[model samples]
Target: MYSVVILANGLFPSTEKPLELLSQADKVVCCDGAAAKLLMWGREPDLIVGDMDSLSDSLKKRYSNIIKKCDGQEDNDLSKAFRSCLDYHPSSIHILGATGIREDHTLANVSLLAEYTELLKDIDCTVDIMTDSGVFYSGFESMQSYECKEGAEVSIFAFDNTLKMTCEGLKYQTDHVIFDSLWKASLNMAKSSKFVLKLNHPAKVIVFICND
Candidate 1:
Protein backbone atom coordinates (compact mmCIF):
# COMPACT_ATOMS: atom_id res chain seq x y z
CA MET A 1 0.00 0.00 0.00
CA TYR A 2 3.08 2.24 -0.01
CA SER A 3 2.51 2.92 3.68
CA VAL A 4 5.15 5.08 5.31
CA VAL A 5 5.83 5.66 9.00
CA ILE A 6 7.24 8.95 10.22
CA LEU A 7 9.09 8.76 13.53
CA ALA A 8 9.19 11.92 15.62
CA ASN A 9 11.43 12.91 18.54
CA GLY A 10 8.84 12.80 21.23
CA LEU A 11 8.21 9.65 23.25
CA PHE A 12 9.43 6.41 21.79
CA PRO A 13 6.73 3.80 21.23
CA SER A 14 7.02 1.17 24.00
CA THR A 15 4.10 -1.08 23.12
CA GLU A 16 3.20 -3.55 20.39
CA LYS A 17 0.96 -1.05 18.62
CA PRO A 18 3.91 1.08 17.54
CA LEU A 19 5.92 -1.99 16.62
CA GLU A 20 3.02 -3.18 14.49
CA LEU A 21 3.01 0.18 12.76
CA LEU A 22 6.69 -0.20 11.97
CA SER A 23 6.20 -3.72 10.66
CA GLN A 24 3.54 -2.50 8.23
CA ALA A 25 5.56 0.48 7.09
CA ASP A 26 7.14 0.21 3.67
CA LYS A 27 9.43 3.10 4.58
CA VAL A 28 10.30 4.66 7.91
CA VAL A 29 11.33 8.32 8.05
CA CYS A 30 12.86 9.69 11.23
CA CYS A 31 12.63 13.30 12.34
CA ASP A 32 16.02 14.69 13.39
CA GLY A 33 16.89 13.39 16.84
CA ALA A 34 14.39 10.57 16.60
CA ALA A 35 16.88 8.71 14.44
CA ALA A 36 18.99 8.24 17.54
CA LYS A 37 16.33 6.13 19.18
CA LEU A 38 15.70 4.17 15.98
CA LEU A 39 19.43 3.44 15.79
CA MET A 40 19.44 2.28 19.40
CA TRP A 41 16.63 -0.08 18.50
CA GLY A 42 18.76 -1.41 15.63
CA ARG A 43 16.33 -0.01 13.03
CA GLU A 44 17.64 2.18 10.26
CA PRO A 45 15.30 4.72 8.73
CA ASP A 46 14.98 5.02 4.98
CA LEU A 47 15.30 8.80 5.28
CA ILE A 48 15.88 11.45 7.93
CA VAL A 49 14.45 14.99 7.70
CA GLY A 50 15.03 17.95 10.04
CA ASP A 51 17.34 20.81 10.97
CA MET A 52 20.08 18.38 12.05
CA ASP A 53 20.56 20.32 15.28
CA SER A 54 19.45 17.46 17.50
CA LEU A 55 21.14 14.72 15.50
CA SER A 56 24.50 13.63 16.86
CA ASP A 57 27.59 14.18 14.74
CA SER A 58 28.40 10.48 14.39
CA LEU A 59 24.87 9.53 13.41
CA LYS A 60 24.69 12.38 10.95
CA LYS A 61 27.89 11.26 9.28
CA ARG A 62 26.79 7.66 9.16
CA TYR A 63 23.44 8.51 7.53
CA SER A 64 24.60 11.50 5.54
CA ASN A 65 23.42 10.07 2.26
CA ILE A 66 19.83 9.66 3.50
CA ILE A 67 19.61 12.87 5.55
CA LYS A 68 17.50 15.65 4.12
CA LYS A 69 18.35 18.88 5.94
CA CYS A 70 15.32 21.15 6.40
CA ASP A 71 16.67 23.88 8.66
CA GLY A 72 13.60 26.04 8.80
CA GLN A 73 12.36 27.35 12.13
CA GLU A 74 8.83 27.96 10.95
CA ASP A 75 8.08 24.25 10.64
CA ASN A 76 9.05 21.73 13.32
CA ASP A 77 11.05 18.61 12.55
CA LEU A 78 7.92 16.49 12.43
CA SER A 79 6.27 18.80 9.92
CA LYS A 80 9.38 18.82 7.81
CA ALA A 81 9.54 15.07 7.84
CA PHE A 82 5.86 14.87 6.97
CA ARG A 83 6.21 17.24 4.06
CA SER A 84 9.09 15.15 2.79
CA CYS A 85 6.81 12.13 2.81
CA LEU A 86 4.60 13.79 0.21
CA ASP A 87 7.38 13.35 -2.31
CA TYR A 88 6.93 9.63 -2.09
CA HIS A 89 3.17 9.91 -2.68
CA PRO A 90 2.46 7.30 -0.08
CA SER A 91 -0.98 5.74 0.16
CA SER A 92 -0.97 6.17 3.92
CA ILE A 93 1.27 7.62 6.59
CA HIS A 94 1.51 6.40 10.16
CA ILE A 95 3.22 8.69 12.63
CA LEU A 96 4.96 7.25 15.69
CA GLY A 97 6.72 8.88 18.66
CA ALA A 98 4.70 12.05 18.04
CA THR A 99 3.43 12.17 21.60
CA GLY A 100 4.76 11.87 25.15
CA ILE A 101 7.59 13.61 27.03
CA ARG A 102 6.98 17.35 26.55
CA GLU A 103 3.29 18.06 26.82
CA ASP A 104 3.43 21.24 24.76
CA HIS A 105 5.40 19.55 22.00
CA THR A 106 3.08 16.59 22.01
CA LEU A 107 0.00 18.79 21.64
CA ALA A 108 1.55 20.77 18.84
CA ASN A 109 2.61 17.63 17.02
CA VAL A 110 -0.83 16.09 17.31
CA SER A 111 -2.47 19.25 16.06
CA LEU A 112 -0.37 19.13 12.92
CA LEU A 113 -2.14 15.99 11.85
CA ALA A 114 -5.07 18.08 10.68
CA GLU A 115 -2.87 20.42 8.71
CA TYR A 116 -1.16 17.52 7.02
CA THR A 117 -4.47 15.91 6.23
CA GLU A 118 -5.70 19.09 4.59
CA LEU A 119 -2.62 19.20 2.41
CA LEU A 120 -3.11 15.63 1.29
CA LYS A 121 -6.85 15.65 0.76
CA ASP A 122 -6.60 16.10 -2.98
CA ILE A 123 -4.27 13.13 -3.22
CA ASP A 124 -6.55 10.88 -1.13
CA CYS A 125 -3.79 9.97 1.31
CA THR A 126 -4.56 8.93 4.87
CA VAL A 127 -2.52 10.00 7.89
CA ASP A 128 -2.83 8.77 11.44
CA ILE A 129 -0.82 9.35 14.60
CA MET A 130 -0.02 6.05 16.31
CA THR A 131 1.04 6.41 19.91
CA ASP A 132 1.85 3.83 22.55
CA SER A 133 -1.65 4.12 23.96
CA GLY A 134 -3.79 4.65 20.87
CA VAL A 135 -4.19 5.94 17.34
CA PHE A 136 -5.30 9.47 16.36
CA TYR A 137 -7.21 10.02 13.13
CA SER A 138 -7.85 13.33 11.38
CA GLY A 139 -10.89 13.81 9.19
CA PHE A 140 -12.83 16.56 7.49
CA GLU A 141 -16.56 16.51 6.78
CA SER A 142 -18.04 13.07 6.11
CA MET A 143 -18.89 9.93 7.98
CA GLN A 144 -16.14 7.79 9.45
CA SER A 145 -16.29 4.66 11.50
CA TYR A 146 -13.52 2.82 13.32
CA GLU A 147 -13.43 -0.68 14.73
CA CYS A 148 -12.45 -0.88 18.36
CA LYS A 149 -12.66 -3.34 21.16
CA GLU A 150 -15.79 -3.09 23.23
CA GLY A 151 -15.34 -0.72 26.19
CA ALA A 152 -12.39 1.02 24.56
CA GLU A 153 -11.90 4.70 25.27
CA VAL A 154 -12.70 7.03 22.40
CA SER A 155 -12.30 10.78 22.34
CA ILE A 156 -13.10 13.33 19.67
CA PHE A 157 -11.72 16.84 19.37
CA ALA A 158 -12.74 19.68 17.09
CA PHE A 159 -9.77 21.19 15.37
CA ASP A 160 -11.81 24.00 13.97
CA ASN A 161 -13.90 26.62 15.78
CA THR A 162 -17.15 25.00 14.75
CA LEU A 163 -18.20 21.50 13.69
CA LYS A 164 -21.58 19.79 13.31
CA MET A 165 -21.27 16.22 14.49
CA THR A 166 -23.23 13.06 15.25
CA CYS A 167 -21.93 9.91 16.82
CA GLU A 168 -23.20 6.38 17.39
CA GLY A 169 -22.09 3.17 19.09
CA LEU A 170 -20.50 5.11 21.94
CA LYS A 171 -21.56 5.36 25.54
CA TYR A 172 -22.27 9.04 24.99
CA GLN A 173 -24.01 9.78 21.70
CA THR A 174 -24.34 13.21 20.17
CA ASP A 175 -27.13 13.96 17.74
CA HIS A 176 -26.48 16.62 15.11
CA VAL A 177 -24.73 18.86 17.59
CA ILE A 178 -22.40 21.77 16.98
CA PHE A 179 -19.12 22.04 18.86
CA ASP A 180 -17.12 25.25 19.08
CA SER A 181 -14.49 24.20 21.55
CA LEU A 182 -11.59 21.81 21.19
CA TRP A 183 -12.65 19.78 24.24
CA LYS A 184 -16.31 19.47 23.34
CA ALA A 185 -16.00 15.69 22.99
CA SER A 186 -13.68 13.78 25.26
CA LEU A 187 -13.51 10.63 27.39
CA ASN A 188 -16.28 8.65 25.74
CA MET A 189 -16.46 4.86 25.80
CA ALA A 190 -17.16 2.49 22.94
CA LYS A 191 -20.35 0.47 23.34
CA SER A 192 -19.79 -1.94 20.47
CA SER A 193 -17.09 -3.24 18.16
CA LYS A 194 -17.21 -0.01 16.13
CA PHE A 195 -18.17 3.65 16.42
CA VAL A 196 -19.26 6.12 13.77
CA LEU A 197 -18.79 9.86 13.43
CA LYS A 198 -20.62 12.03 10.94
CA LEU A 199 -19.76 15.63 10.22
CA ASN A 200 -21.46 18.33 8.14
CA HIS A 201 -19.39 20.83 6.20
CA PRO A 202 -15.64 20.67 5.83
CA ALA A 203 -13.86 20.97 9.18
CA LYS A 204 -10.93 19.43 10.93
CA VAL A 205 -11.49 16.99 13.77
CA ILE A 206 -9.44 14.40 15.60
CA VAL A 207 -10.62 10.95 16.63
CA PHE A 208 -8.54 9.14 19.23
CA ILE A 209 -9.20 5.43 19.81
CA CYS A 210 -7.48 3.55 22.59
CA ASN A 211 -5.62 0.32 21.89
CA ASP A 212 -7.40 -2.90 22.80
Candidate 2:
Protein backbone atom coordinates (compact mmCIF):
# COMPACT_ATOMS: atom_id res chain seq x y z
CA MET A 1 0.00 0.00 0.00
CA TYR A 2 1.22 3.48 -0.85
CA SER A 3 1.40 5.89 2.08
CA VAL A 4 1.67 9.66 1.90
CA VAL A 5 2.42 12.09 4.71
CA ILE A 6 1.27 15.71 4.57
CA LEU A 7 3.16 18.06 6.87
CA ALA A 8 1.38 21.33 7.59
CA ASN A 9 2.76 24.62 8.93
CA GLY A 10 1.27 24.26 12.36
CA LEU A 11 3.24 23.49 15.49
CA PHE A 12 6.23 21.37 14.49
CA PRO A 13 5.88 17.77 15.61
CA SER A 14 8.16 16.82 18.54
CA THR A 15 6.56 13.59 19.71
CA GLU A 16 8.09 10.25 18.76
CA LYS A 17 4.95 8.80 17.12
CA PRO A 18 4.51 11.60 14.59
CA LEU A 19 8.23 11.77 13.94
CA GLU A 20 8.30 8.04 13.32
CA LEU A 21 5.43 8.29 10.81
CA LEU A 22 7.17 11.08 8.96
CA SER A 23 10.41 9.16 8.71
CA GLN A 24 8.65 6.05 7.46
CA ALA A 25 6.30 7.70 4.98
CA ASP A 26 6.59 6.48 1.42
CA LYS A 27 6.26 10.09 0.27
CA VAL A 28 6.21 13.28 2.30
CA VAL A 29 4.38 16.42 1.13
CA CYS A 30 4.92 19.75 2.84
CA CYS A 31 2.42 22.60 3.02
CA ASP A 32 4.14 25.87 2.17
CA GLY A 33 6.11 27.01 5.26
CA ALA A 34 6.18 23.47 6.63
CA ALA A 35 8.98 22.64 4.21
CA ALA A 36 11.38 24.73 6.29
CA LYS A 37 10.34 22.93 9.46
CA LEU A 38 10.81 19.55 7.78
CA LEU A 39 14.25 20.63 6.58
CA MET A 40 15.17 21.76 10.09
CA TRP A 41 14.18 18.31 11.28
CA GLY A 42 16.74 16.92 8.78
CA ARG A 43 14.19 15.38 6.42
CA GLU A 44 13.12 16.37 2.93
CA PRO A 45 9.62 16.22 1.49
CA ASP A 46 8.93 14.65 -1.89
CA LEU A 47 6.89 17.69 -2.86
CA ILE A 48 6.24 21.18 -1.45
CA VAL A 49 2.67 22.43 -2.06
CA GLY A 50 0.60 25.59 -1.58
CA ASP A 51 1.10 29.24 -2.49
CA MET A 52 4.70 30.53 -2.24
CA ASP A 53 3.87 33.28 0.22
CA SER A 54 5.15 31.49 3.33
CA LEU A 55 8.21 29.86 1.78
CA SER A 56 11.61 31.52 1.80
CA ASP A 57 13.00 32.67 -1.53
CA SER A 58 16.27 30.80 -1.15
CA LEU A 59 14.59 27.54 -0.23
CA LYS A 60 12.10 27.97 -3.04
CA LYS A 61 14.94 28.50 -5.47
CA ARG A 62 16.79 25.48 -4.09
CA TYR A 63 13.77 23.17 -4.27
CA SER A 64 12.26 24.72 -7.37
CA ASN A 65 12.00 21.41 -9.11
CA ILE A 66 9.89 19.87 -6.33
CA ILE A 67 7.89 23.00 -5.52
CA LYS A 68 4.31 23.02 -6.73
CA LYS A 69 2.68 26.44 -6.70
CA CYS A 70 -1.01 26.15 -5.88
CA ASP A 71 -2.42 29.68 -5.91
CA GLY A 72 -5.92 28.77 -4.79
CA GLN A 73 -7.05 31.12 -2.03
CA GLU A 74 -10.20 29.14 -1.34
CA ASP A 75 -8.37 26.22 0.28
CA ASN A 76 -5.93 26.32 3.20
CA ASP A 77 -2.36 25.19 2.84
CA LEU A 78 -3.12 21.86 4.43
CA SER A 79 -6.01 21.26 2.03
CA LYS A 80 -3.82 22.22 -0.88
CA ALA A 81 -1.18 19.80 0.29
CA PHE A 82 -3.80 17.08 0.65
CA ARG A 83 -5.13 17.64 -2.86
CA SER A 84 -1.58 17.54 -4.17
CA CYS A 85 -0.98 14.18 -2.51
CA LEU A 86 -3.95 12.67 -4.39
CA ASP A 87 -2.00 12.84 -7.66
CA TYR A 88 0.38 10.27 -6.19
CA HIS A 89 -2.60 7.91 -5.66
CA PRO A 90 -1.79 7.09 -2.05
CA SER A 91 -3.73 4.38 -0.25
CA SER A 92 -3.31 6.08 3.11
CA ILE A 93 -2.59 9.67 4.10
CA HIS A 94 -1.28 10.76 7.48
CA ILE A 95 -1.48 14.45 8.36
CA LEU A 96 1.16 15.88 10.72
CA GLY A 97 1.68 19.32 12.18
CA ALA A 98 -2.08 19.90 11.72
CA THR A 99 -2.85 20.93 15.26
CA GLY A 100 -1.47 23.06 18.13
CA ILE A 101 -0.65 26.78 18.37
CA ARG A 102 -3.74 28.80 17.41
CA GLU A 103 -6.96 27.27 18.66
CA ASP A 104 -8.92 28.56 15.68
CA HIS A 105 -6.50 26.99 13.26
CA THR A 106 -6.45 23.76 15.21
CA LEU A 107 -10.23 23.51 15.21
CA ALA A 108 -10.44 24.32 11.54
CA ASN A 109 -7.85 21.70 10.69
CA VAL A 110 -9.56 19.02 12.76
CA SER A 111 -12.97 19.73 11.20
CA LEU A 112 -11.50 19.25 7.75
CA LEU A 113 -10.95 15.59 8.48
CA ALA A 114 -14.59 14.86 7.71
CA GLU A 115 -14.39 16.65 4.42
CA TYR A 116 -11.22 14.80 3.50
CA THR A 117 -12.85 11.48 4.20
CA GLU A 118 -15.83 12.36 2.02
CA LEU A 119 -13.55 13.38 -0.83
CA LEU A 120 -11.71 10.08 -0.66
CA LYS A 121 -14.70 7.82 -0.01
CA ASP A 122 -14.80 6.35 -3.49
CA ILE A 123 -11.02 5.92 -3.62
CA ASP A 124 -10.83 3.72 -0.51
CA CYS A 125 -8.10 5.81 1.11
CA THR A 126 -7.79 6.26 4.86
CA VAL A 127 -6.98 9.66 6.31
CA ASP A 128 -5.79 10.60 9.80
CA ILE A 129 -4.55 13.69 11.61
CA MET A 130 -1.84 12.91 14.12
CA THR A 131 -1.12 15.32 16.92
CA ASP A 132 1.15 15.31 19.94
CA SER A 133 -1.67 14.22 22.23
CA GLY A 134 -3.76 11.98 19.97
CA VAL A 135 -4.83 11.04 16.48
CA PHE A 136 -8.06 12.05 14.76
CA TYR A 137 -9.94 9.82 12.32
CA SER A 138 -13.01 10.60 10.23
CA GLY A 139 -15.62 7.97 9.47
CA PHE A 140 -18.09 8.23 6.62
CA GLU A 141 -19.26 4.65 6.59
CA SER A 142 -22.29 3.41 8.46
CA MET A 143 -20.24 1.26 10.80
CA GLN A 144 -16.66 1.57 11.94
CA SER A 145 -14.36 -0.36 14.24
CA TYR A 146 -11.30 0.93 16.02
CA GLU A 147 -8.61 -0.86 17.99
CA CYS A 148 -8.01 0.67 21.37
CA LYS A 149 -6.58 -0.04 24.79
CA GLU A 150 -8.87 -0.73 27.72
CA GLY A 151 -9.67 2.54 29.54
CA ALA A 152 -8.13 4.62 26.80
CA GLU A 153 -9.56 8.11 26.34
CA VAL A 154 -11.93 8.48 23.41
CA SER A 155 -13.98 11.36 22.03
CA ILE A 156 -16.66 11.20 19.35
CA PHE A 157 -17.98 14.17 17.40
CA ALA A 158 -20.68 13.97 14.79
CA PHE A 159 -20.33 16.22 11.81
CA ASP A 160 -24.02 15.68 11.15
CA ASN A 161 -25.79 16.27 14.41
CA THR A 162 -29.00 14.62 13.22
CA LEU A 163 -27.24 11.31 12.66
CA LYS A 164 -28.02 8.66 15.28
CA MET A 165 -25.39 6.22 16.44
CA THR A 166 -24.96 3.34 18.86
CA CYS A 167 -21.59 2.22 20.09
CA GLU A 168 -20.10 -0.85 21.76
CA GLY A 169 -17.03 -1.23 23.97
CA LEU A 170 -17.24 2.34 25.21
CA LYS A 171 -17.43 3.12 28.90
CA TYR A 172 -20.40 5.44 28.26
CA GLN A 173 -23.12 4.31 25.87
CA THR A 174 -24.18 6.60 23.03
CA ASP A 175 -27.35 4.74 22.10
CA HIS A 176 -29.70 7.31 23.61
CA VAL A 177 -27.57 10.42 23.23
CA ILE A 178 -28.54 13.34 21.05
CA PHE A 179 -25.62 14.51 18.87
CA ASP A 180 -26.99 18.05 18.38
CA SER A 181 -24.14 19.30 20.52
CA LEU A 182 -20.49 18.80 19.73
CA TRP A 183 -19.63 17.39 23.16
CA LYS A 184 -22.72 15.25 23.53
CA ALA A 185 -20.71 12.01 23.42
CA SER A 186 -17.22 13.23 24.11
CA LEU A 187 -14.76 12.40 26.91
CA ASN A 188 -15.81 8.76 26.85
CA MET A 189 -13.47 5.85 27.63
CA ALA A 190 -13.00 2.48 26.02
CA LYS A 191 -14.21 -0.52 28.01
CA SER A 192 -12.13 -2.98 26.06
CA SER A 193 -9.32 -3.20 23.49
CA LYS A 194 -11.70 -2.67 20.61
CA PHE A 195 -14.75 -0.48 19.96
CA VAL A 196 -17.41 -0.36 17.28
CA LEU A 197 -19.59 2.54 16.16
CA LYS A 198 -22.79 1.81 14.27
CA LEU A 199 -24.70 4.61 12.68
CA ASN A 200 -28.40 4.68 11.83
CA HIS A 201 -27.63 5.99 8.37
CA PRO A 202 -24.85 7.46 6.26
CA ALA A 203 -23.18 10.29 8.15
CA LYS A 204 -19.87 11.80 9.03
CA VAL A 205 -18.19 11.32 12.41
CA ILE A 206 -14.84 12.34 13.76
CA VAL A 207 -13.22 10.12 16.38
CA PHE A 208 -10.28 11.10 18.54
CA ILE A 209 -8.14 8.36 20.08
CA CYS A 210 -5.67 9.53 22.69
CA ASN A 211 -2.10 8.29 22.83
CA ASP A 212 -2.21 7.68 26.56
Best by lDDT: 2
How does each model score on TM-score? 0.92, 0.95
RMSD of 2: 1.2
Q: Write the per-residue lDDT of candidate 1 for residues 1-212, one digit (tens) a residue.
A: 79999999988888998988887788999999999998888788999999999999999999999999987689899999998988888999999999998999989988899899888879968999999889998877588778889999998988554566788899987664456665678889999998888877677788899887
Q: lDDT per residue, candidate 2, 3-53, as tens digits?
A: 999998899988899989998899999998889999999998799999989
| Model 1 misplacement above 4 A | 176-180
Model 1 pairs whose backbones collide: none
- Give, for candidate 1, the lowest lDDT window spanning 10 residues: 174-183
Q: How high is the CA lDDT of each candidate model?
A: 0.87, 0.91
